[model samples]
Structure formats: structure tokens, C-alpha cells
Target: MDINRVSARNVHQAHYELIVIGSGFGSTFFLDEALKHITGRALVIEWGDYQPWAWQVEAQSNSPIAPESTYKNSGNKPWNTTIALGGGTNCWYAQTPRLHPNDFKTRALYGVGHDWPLGYDDLEPYYCRAEQIMSISGDPDIGKVLPRSQPYPQPPHKGTSVDALMKAAMPDHHFICPTARPRMATANRSACCANARCSQCPVNAKFTAENGFPSLFSHPKVDVCLKSEVRTLEYSGNQISGATIASEGGEYKVFGDVFVLGANAIQSPAILLRSDIDYGQTGRGLHEQVGANVEVFLEGLKSLDGSTITTGYNYYFADGDFRRNRASCLVSFENRWWPFGLRKERGRWDEMLSLSVVVEDLPNPDNRVTIDPQSGQAVVDYRGESSYAKAGIEHVFDNLDKLLAPLPVESINSRIWRPTESHVQGTLRMGIKDDGSVIDQNMLHHRMRNLVVVGTSSFPSCSPAAPSLTAAALSIRAAELLYS
Candidate 1:
């Protein structure tokens, strides 16, 4: 937690078998893999720190963007993204849901983006590995999708008081199904205690890089240097020789035989562009599966009272909309306040269970993440219609109303203009043609042989399910291709 001491002054002397940028789920997962598999010198360059200054903490306390950037809201405006040791995974709401099988081939069905080179079968093993790594727990059969190879490593957390109330009101509605079990830091190394202040898990049940990857910091094969911002790539010809890192004290060049960019969709592509390493469409064709919480307020009920769970009912999987049966999922207590613990301390348990319907958006080029020319900073240009998004909202609301006929539910509101996307994909899209993609199926850069690009950003289509598990799945594949 010593943020001020880990300076970027020793980049020139640093050596690694692999150099990873950013500290998000994608980057952290890959680094975890390298630590186990590679066995040589590996270093992760994280832009942020675990403990921000008092001012930084105050600035990032209430952001809708929540886990990603400490300084920004979940909107079109630019904000200071976090540079913590754990990255955004530190503050993320660990709700891991698998992508539907059809999500892998959206192009064949809807002609939107290119189909993923791989599919569910290809990722299933890694998905299981990732779930185990994160210590996921859930019911075996909560939905139509998610065929697990093994049982969850842990048991489901108990729901809160508000969750219990919702279950009582809508006894038949599968508003809250078996949600994903969160991975957190714990002394027992088993499951989380699932306490009220679980977000700040005294025992780490939530899977965070802060707690997960830090265990590897002592390994000689792994070196995690925080506060190290990669300025540019040091290349010999087209291959990356090393990278220039700028920190609080000074800057130096670090070299690696192989380089992997796992800086999420925006920062990853931005680093490539800044390195003057263009593989055709460097940052175009970005696709983020935008999400909005369509909340329905039920009259005359206390807040839902149930144990915390990541299980959700995928009504969309059966709905025949946009060529896919699934249109959205029901998150019965997503915005519900009691389980979050803060509202409970304030004695606000009289609230009703707020249902959140999550829907997937049609991919369009108009919605993208790009580097702003004037400010030279990353900017998100989201221009999809809120009306189309509401269609899914309406769809979910109608079903909930029918199921709980006399539950006195009224007034549905869809409020996610610029969605908080943990599943960011597409920017350096993968495809057959070099003119359109930055990397090929093997995750090799179209232009550079030694350089590899992994993570959700390479996915041609943004899948409906969350991308963290899938991204880890892809990283498992990428490591093989890189080391082979």
C-alpha cells in the first residue's frame, strides 16, 4: 500500500519474459497465468495504485463508473481512470456471468460484427479455470446457459433482508436466481463470510487483483511495479524491445522478449497507437455491449430481504427478439440498497426490491471509444437510441408484471445513458482481413510477430454475457500461442 515508494525509475534495468500493461481483469488474469506457466521474469506495469491519496479517494467515492475510473462518472464526459494496484477489479461488483453460446457468432445471426474465431467449447475449460481462480460459487442449473465442467469452488453467499422480502412478494418470479459467487480475500482461503460490509471484505471473497495477484508479488519470476506508466514502446524494427515507463520520480526503458497488451479496450489500443505500431485499423470498430438498469418500484413493501447472490433470471434467453431468444436478464435486487450495507446502517430497510433488467444493444460504429483529438485523452462517443434500449426494458417489465399480477409494481425507469461497461471489446477487432483487424485468430498482431494483443478488445462482437471470464479464457489461449 506504499503508493509513493514504487517509482518508475528502473525501467532500463528491468527484464521480463512478458510485459503486461494495465491492471484490469484481463491484464491481471493473464499475469496470473504467466506467473504459473512461464516461470521466467515477468512484470506488470500498472498505472494506478491501491491506496489513493485522501483527495483521490474523496474524488472517486461516489462515481457511477464505480470500479473503473476513480474520477469519472459513467457518462460521455472524460474522467481520471484509476491507477491502482488491483486496477478496476478492486471495486467491481463481482457478478460473473458466462456469455451465451450464440454470442460467439453474432455476425452469422445479425450481420453485426465478425464472429469470434473461437466459441463456447473453446473457452469452456478456461472459463472453469477462471471461475476456480476467482473462487466462484452458484447453483448448477439457474439458467439455460452456463454449462460448467465442474462445481463452483465455493458456496453461494446468503442473501440480505431486502432480498428475502422480494422473494416473499414474488414467490413465483425468478427475479433472483443463483448469481455468481464473489471471490474475496479471506484468512481461511475458502468462501467469503458475506458480511454487510463485504465490499470492503475484511476477508477477501470478492475476486480483486489487489488481493488475487498480490500473492504473486513475492515470486521471483513475477515483479509487480505499481505507479509505472508505460509512456511508449521501445522497438527494434517492428518487434517490441522494451518500453519507456514514466513514474513520479523519473523514467527508464524496460525490455521484454515478448509483449502483451491487456490494457482493456481503450488504454490497450491507445498504447499501440502511441507506439507508432499500426496494424491497419488500430482503434476502429470498437464494440461495447452497453447496459442499462431498468428498475421497477413495487408499492407497499419493505426493501427486499435475501442473501447476496449473483444469480439472475435470463428471460432474454427465451425471448425471440433480434434473432436471439434472450434479450435481457432480471437482476431483482441490483439497485436494491440493503445488501450494499450502507443503506442498512442508515436504517432504510423499508424500501422495496428494485428489479434491474439488463439488455444487450445492437452493435454500431457510432458508439465507440476513441482518443480525443483536442484533449488528446480517451473519450467515449455513445450515440445509440435510448428508445431501443427501453424496448428490452419494457419487455422485462411486462413479464414481471404478469408473473406477479397483484404485487403492486408500478413505474419502470431505464437509466443508463452511457453504460458502465466492464465488458469492453472490439477496438482492435480480430478478423480474417488485415485491413480491418489489429490481431489475427492466434492473437498475433497483423503487422508485428513478437507482439500480441489479447483480452475482450480483440473480440469482434460484444457478447451478451459478461466478458471477464471469456477474456480470461482468451488469455489462456493467447499464452499458448505466445509461448509456443
Candidate 2:
């Protein structure tokens, strides 16, 4: 079955059974799962064009942090994201960790944030399914920290010498970080070459939306339209009727029985605000991870060499009584040595090691995304109270020497890499109420019966782990509910 690629001008249908916006994990996962249960016509509207693997690798190699040319960053804080077909997965580091069970009930356990409408157990099976699709690799023992119904799809990637040394030095604190890089050549992706460049795997070794679900595009029931920027949703009496889209050629409307907003945490809320929805919670509860990186020079041990980007992590302090007052911190040992730029100066770039600490940020209603009534652009007024995050950072700094005591460290320097909004979350929070939340457990709008929103935007709170895996699981779960 060939995927019918149609231009926005060629969509002659009066209405589709389902219309999904965005081509990221949220949209792709939902569509992939829905296709298993339903056979009706589905239309996917993507704002960006299809980016081939080789083209993405070459483009990323030239500009590491370059923003997508088609996206506009009108907000006070720039959202570092790609607008291409696979979305951020095109440039993601591929770190895939499940949110701890405690993450779902933070408000009940730690008294910091709101509890999710659902819990970790409800999504564990879906997490396994998502991991299988992404060809995730990790130590099965990671389930000790976060419970899992099944082991990862692949064995853990071989760690670098630096990772082994770190584990030996801090045996009680170190563990392998779960990742979405294929360990062996699979049908859709190649085995990782240990290039330390997982962000843009030159050989298409990293799992992404495009590689994971090639059949989704070509399925007979699916129709994909590229470069169709969705502007606003049309609704009547609490039911979404259609969406107004703008393309290079002109503007038009596409009707659908069910509408899904998967344009990510920022753009999704922006679209809702533009539609003049009265839902007070549409653009509230915005937050993201607060992160810092420390550079350490090992006196004798060799670092870098040839290895995966991130192999080991320190999660001993990820959770505990510390959650009562401050956020938990997850430390990752980064194997990418090129970022240090020490090769030219010392010629001993292998001696440099970078440890990144990420502190989870609680939701703050004041820190949110709003549309500029005048400019008609999304404006994020993010003033995240960092007291909890700062406490977590200070704890990591205080215990840094003790954790790396076995290593002969020449010097240690730390810098706070301010939040880049790369992990944008919690804009369209889910809850049991309509007054304070925009979506429900099924990701359906509290008031709009036929509308569903997927992705991190519906997250009530963030966990120490990366949100992509959790987002994928949630999207799949939402699809199942909608299909039923």
C-alpha cells in the first residue's frame, strides 16, 4: 500500500473521519495505533515537509542548534524544536526513560504539584509497546527504579571507558540510561556505529517517527498533507467541526469528525488561544526541566574515545525524602566530547567529561503560553519559581566530590544552562475538572466532545526523565480510548 501524499489544494473530500495535526511522537503514535482498530479515512496535516534521513544528518552536522526555517519563535523564550515530519526526533538525543511511579502522584507524595488523572501502571503496557516500536535499549534492571511489564527491546549499548570508570567509582549511584538507539541492525534502522552523535545518526541508526512507522504513511486509510499549517479550529456547540489551514498556495478549511491537536506544547496551545476558546486552562500550567552541566577533567582516566552519546546515569539521588522540599535530580554522564572543544587546546580531549544534572520543575500556572492579541503570535511569559530546582542543583554540587572521589579530578567547573524550553510541557494540563484543566485522562477536551489533544502539553507535571517516551505512551493510550 502506497501512502497517498496529497497537496492541500487536492484534498477534495468534504470530511475525514479523523484529522490529526502535527507529525511528532504524539500525532504519529496515535495515528499508528488507531489504524490497528479503525479503518476509516484519516488525514494528517503537517506544517513541515518530509525530511529524509541523509538530508537531516547533513543539515544537523552543518548547524547543530539551528532552528527550523519554517517555524517562527515569537514567544519571549525560543522553543528549540524542528518543524520537520519527524519533529524533534529528527535531532533528539534519543534518551528514553520511563517516568517513575512516584512522578504520577507527586502532589499526594511530595505536596508540590498536581497528581495526574492516571498513574504509571495504566501506561506501563503502552510504554512497552512504544519501546518496541522505537527499538529501545537498556538494562532490564532499570525496572528496579521504575517498574516495567517487559524488558527493553534491545540490549544496552556498550559503555565508554569513562562510563565504566564512573560506574566503578560510584557503584552505588550509577546505572545505564535507557535510550532509543538500535543496538543491532533492525528491519527499519541500522545498528548504532558508536559515533557519539546520536542527535543525528548518520547511518539512520536512531529510532524516529519516520523509521518506526513507515507503514503509517502508506496505509490505505491514511492521507498525509505536508506544508499545511493549521491556523484555528472551527467548532459549534462544543464539537470541533473543522480546521482552517494556511499553505503556500492559499487558505482553506478541512472538516473532520474528530480533531486532534498534536502540534506540541507551544503551538498547540497557541492554536487554541487563536480559536478564542473560553477554556481558562488552555494555556496554563507551563513548566520544564531545570538543568545544569559540570565539566570535569580526569587526571589519568581516558574519556570520549568512541562510544554512544550518553551511556551511564546516576539515579541514586533521583528520589527520596528530598522530594518533600526540593525537586529530584538525575545526573547523566555525557560521552559527546566534541562539545568541549578541548581537542585543539590540550590535544587530550579524551580526558574531559561532562555530567549533566536535570531537576524537575513543578507546574506554575503563572508560567504559561499566551497569544499576543496584537501580533497574533504565541507569547510565553515563563517565570518559573526555581526554589525547588535550585535546591536540587545545590545538592548535586555539594555531593559532586563524594560521588567522583575515586577519580583523580584535576578541575571541576559548573555552569547553569538556563531552561531552553526544549522540553516544553504542561500547557494543556489534564485533570478531573473542567475549570482548571483542558483535557481529561483520555486526552479529550473537557468540554469539546470530539476534540482530543496529545503530547506533553497535556502533562500535569514533569518527571526527572525525558518526556518523549511518556508522551508517546500517552498518545497511544489516547488513541485506544478514541477508537473504543
Q: What is the C-alpha lDDT of each candidate?
A: 0.58, 0.80
lDDT of 2 by residue, 1-484 (tens): 1357888877743589999998788888998888888667899998877877777677764223345333344445556666767677777778998888889988888888889999999999999999988989886767777787888889987776776776777666676778888778899888877777776788888888777877788888988888788888989999999998888769888899988899878789989899987485788887888887788887867776534678887786688877989888888887775445464446566777788888888888887778777755677777754698788888888888887776778888656565463787889988886549888999999888898899889899878789999999999999998888
- TM per model? 0.79, 0.93
TM-score, cand. 2: 0.93
Q: In TM-score terms, which candidate is top?
A: 2
Worst 10 residues of 2 by lDDT: 62-71
lDDT of 2: 0.80
**1-484: candidate 1 lDDT, tens digit per residue:** 2222334565467777888777676676766666666867777787765552233335544122333342112365332233466555655556766777776676676554468767778787887788777777664554335567777666655554444544555444333443233533354243544443433444445666545555655566666677667767877776888888877768787888888887767777767766777666776665554454444455555443444534334433332345443344434344344322322323434444444446565545555655644533455565543354456555655666564444455444344333454455677777676547778777777777777787777877655456666777677667755665
